[model samples]
Target chain A: MVERHEVRLSGSGGQGMLLAGIILAEAAILADKNAVQSQSYGPEARGGASRSEVVISNTDIDYPKVTQPEIFMALTQEAYNKYHHDLGPNALLVVDESLSLTDDLPEKSRVVRVPIIESATETLKRPIVANIVALGVLVGASSIVEHEFIEKAVLNRVPRGTEELNRRALDLGFQLAAGAVGGNK
Target chain B: MSPTVKLLQGNEACVEGALAAGVKFFAGYPITPSTEIAELLAERLPLVGGRFMQMEDEIASMAAVIGASLTGTKAMTATSGPGFSLKQENLGFAIFTEIPCVVVNVMRGGPSTGLPTSPAQGDVMQARWGTHGDHPVIAVYPASVPEAYELTIKAFNLSEKYRTPVIMLMDEVVGHMREKVELPDVPQIPIEERPRPTVSKENYLPYDNNQGDVPPLANFGDGYHFHVTGLTHDQTGFPTSAPAKAKVLYERLHRKIENNLDDILMWETKDMEDAEIGVLAYGSTARSAARAVSLAREQGIKAGLMRPITIWPFPEKLITQYASQLKSLVVAEMNLGQYVNEVERAAQGQVPIKRVLQANGELIRPDTILQAIMEVK
Candidate 1:
């Protein structure tokens, strides 16, 4: 298990990346690990740069903000361009399939591309669950927290009537990640 | 037995703390970093049979808090930098009249309307002297989410005990950060209510110091027809321009906090047994300083941390004691230089002081503080 893991999730405002970060941190806490989640965004309610960072550890967490993320997920090309440079060595970089990876990206870092938004919109028929789908993809790709804990946290956080939709979106995300990584884990 | 733990944002924990401390009324205007405190209270206060009011603006919100407290309700208001500035005049009013209330200033970058979403420690002096006059202020700052919960309760407790406005000085980082908090049972948390008059209604004096520095406060309409005013008042609570009466009132206002420093001052010292260098920090910056201290210890530097949970009343005695022992001190803060001046004053040139300052909206990283620690070492 990764003793301490830092995760960064970035997208435009209204994308619910902040909520996704909260759910991820909640999942870590449910697994009995220490976790902290923090976010930064422009004044705009939507369509501006939005980023959320979570740090999970088995020990006490100090310096709550993420400095270097070992696991990074960016849903938009703009976000990926803005934040992908600060990945830790041997970091796991997860991005939407629509974004292209640059050649100068960190050599030791592993990149996983999945159709997160597509899975939520096309498979689940709900664009709002894209954040949930992203959570699944990131967690499924990194195995940061146990899958059951993430599922529980997702159910606990999402709207009351949309549990089934979010559950499906999460499953689709895991499937997408599994397919992208050659079904290894 | 396993503790009941939950993932809570700092602002949410603050609301819980306020409720746990028996706060029954919230009056606030929505502002970033602090809006969540008001928002969560708006939802939860009514469920607990409490009152939540979003007044026309910050000034009115502060006034409303004073009004609620006058009626024997534990009241609070939350705001950011600009709003904190707007509430200062009334904050002074609350201070002068000795009204018990909590004002939460989630500090953001500012001289005026500055970075609304970014963190800063610029309000250190403001929390103490923002409200005009020579009144004593109690401002408690929390470095973590749990401390946020604990200190919010303490803020209310101190306010009620002192019959003064206590400032819960939170910054953007601690206000927005989410962490795992093992919440204690409601009945287990210590709650402090304002001291009520034991005397009969006809004999009650609002600002009477004969009983003690903090006289028992009688709630409005509690059969006690006592006057409270911003103007300097005597024991009878009437407006007085008499020099001797005003002097006694002002002296007592400061003496209440000064004499009770042992109770009001809260701080934490880590690894100071044989340390030659010390780091003094508060709020979120202290979190980084703690990590930096650990790292410095690993590198064979005898570094220690002194985190002041109670920002105002300044923790001078502790700083003086530590300064006498340490070779040098490093003060880390989100603002360029605010609390460092206080540290220098407290240290009194006994030791050299280094400041790890940042006001560009980003948190002061551990490495930056570590570098300062190295310099001091």
Candidate 2:
């Protein structure tokens, strides 16, 4: 029953994907699982491509970075194109509806297309918590980390006075992931 | 405050470790992969009543730490590759002056800002000899975020115990990696303070050798009039070019570490009780090497791992002893043949040395290291 899961969150530098990675790892730790999070970003503060990787295991994690990630999220078209080919077989590829994938993806893979950004702007009224929405969707689909721990980590990490907004955004993500899972069939 | 368990980045662990080690002063310049250490210290040091200053440059930061240490403050500074280069002169000065301070170099791709954000072990030899002349260094490397916390505390402890500069050599991979760490209770962990001079002011010879090799030091403005110079000095603490005095000073500096190898050396070995091939690794690469060793063993290839936690004192005795039982040695690192050279020297043609090197910022994969282990006869 001791299993290892690798997740990578890719997006632009300002999208808070790196924070999402941290939250994911923290959630895994809260659930009594071993976890590590690492990130790679370009020099630019906003427009540059950013990628954060989190690995959760029931035992000690040796290699922290995800190579062929089982759970990969690409919030931007650039991130999708750059990382689409590196998915492991039967992997879960999560992407925003804003990114159109023209290239062929690996066979037997599950692609969850969620309106993460759109939901953040329209429903949450705060586009800044889109990363939390993405986190909720990932956890909702995979169950690599529990929903309660992810929410706890979010509350611990988010800026003061924004807890309610972030929690709402996370719940919205969970709903979106549920809808995406239903629609994918 | 009760001990708390939290997920912390390697840099954050270092800040906490430095805090636990009784570090009251930190002077550093922000650099890639290592800037977070300074940033966290800026926020956390004040809460603990420690002072944190961002110096104008790496050199000034090094100089400031040395100045602060002279006043009996447990001071430290953190920097990356290029900044580590800039700190060499002051580092040498501290080595010559026998100042107790911790210098953190979170290694990045080097040469000249080679790859600021990428991880590299290009500073391994540099940590040993980046400074100009003959000196003894005690540099320790951590392979995990929690070890980053533990070894940082050890770095400060070693610096104070030996009265020398201790380098906490971290790479980008470990520096930036976040892991869940249980902080040790502060009251339970042992903290060391620098040895103080026992003699009265009139008899306080700053460079006095009448005591043991590590002479007790007195704070600069604490009722003691002492001269601290980079130049060679004698028992009176005055500059002297006398042949006998210079020889004694130089030999003692080397011997203090050389004679105490047992106290300074630390390493970790796995499944090596009866193995033909030994994989030698350190820092981030050690993780990969450990995996490779486990995989090789699973495949029925009798392989083992010898990882050095205390890197700079070289752990020659362990390498030599381990080499005696091995048919071949595989040295794996993020840099190209940095520590392997030391292994080659220690192995002394006793076994074939195979190097698994990756200097382009990316970590060496476990499969690649396992491939090397498989290829080894």
Best model per DockQ: 1
lDDT per residue as tens, model 1, B303-360: 9999999888888888878788889899898887888888898888999999889999
Worst 10 residues of 1 chain B by lDDT: B182-191
The list of candidate 2 runs beyond 4 A from truth reads: A182-185
Alpha carbon deviation, residue A167, candidate 2 (Å): 1.9
Residues B8-112, candidate 2: write the lDDT tens digits.
989999998998898889998999899999998999888988899998999999999999999999999999989999999999999889999999999999889
Candidate 1's residue-wise lDDT over A1-185, tens digit each? 43778999998888999999999999998998999998874564367767899999999987788888999899998888888887888888888888888766666788888788888788888888899888888888889998999999999998999899989888888887888873211
Interface RMSD of each: 0.9, 1.0
Report lDDT (Cα) of residue B125, candidate 2: 89
TM of chain B vs. native, candidate 1 = 0.98
User: Model 1: how large is the Cα RMSD against the reference?
Assistant: 2.0
